[model samples]
Target: MSDDDLAATLATEAGRLLLDVRREFADASVDDRKAAGDQRSHDFLMAALAAERPDDAVLSEEGADDPVRLSSRRVWIVDPLDGTREFSEPGRDDWAVHVALWQDGELVAGAVALPAQGVTLATPTVATPPAAPQHPRIVVSRTRPPDIAM
Candidate 1:
């Protein structure tokens, strides 16, 4: 598969795995749920990347930072579970999975999957943002809003 297609596929699959982990660990403590989600999703993405693109380097949030990627021509940067806190919280849909490919000097492909919302936005097919409402609004983190947003 092409780099763009690979990124989208991996991200979407990882999101599905995270959803399964959340359901399986529904009764676990918050910390436990977060840990499970992070590890499982990371493992899935790492293995998939390794198998599909054996020569490419990978930088993942849950894995140790390998210096080898610095010299590599292509690197896959992934956050297997982007919002661990929101993921563990019941009824929250803000969590997501992120996958990106950086090659040479630029980001060539990327994808973001919102599993709870059942949405996967990917590259190559540029996403057109919905028309802004007359009354605009900014959504910021509830606990730590940026100064600009505040």
Candidate 2:
């Protein structure tokens, strides 16, 4: 399939895996659950990309930073689980899975899946950004505050 299709599929599948992890570790400690979810989704996404696009480079939040990606023509940047804290919390739906394709210089494709919300936003399915809200709001991470906030 094309890069766009692959990105969306990977993000969606990874989100599903994370949801399963949450169910399987319902009684586990938050730290344990978070670790499991991160590793599981990271491994799934990495293996899928290797099998599907063996020639391209990958940069993952849970994987080693390979210098090879800097020289490659195409690179896949993924965050298997963008919000570990949110994922570990019961009933929280703000966490997401991110899969993006950086080709040449610009981003060619990308996807973000919010599993609990059952929403997957992909490049193929996205329309122009909605107009700015009359009352804009900033959402901050509960676990890691930005350096600027320090």
Candidates' lDDT values, in order? 0.93, 0.93
For model 1, residues 14-79, the per-residue Cα lDDT tens digits are 999999998999999999999999999999999999999999999999999999999999999999
In candidate 2, stretches whose alpha carbon ends up further than 4 angstroms from where it belongs are 125-150
TM values, all candidates: 0.83, 0.83
- Backbone clash total, candidate 1: 0
Backbone clashes per model, in order? 0, 0
lDDT of 1: 0.93
Could you tell me which 10 consecutive residues in candidate 2 have the lowest summed lDDT? 121-130
lDDT of 2 by residue, 2-108 (tens): 88899999999999999999999999999999999999999999999999999999999999999999999999999999999999999999999999998899788
lDDT of 1 at 102: 89
- In candidate 2, position 47 carries an lDDT of 98
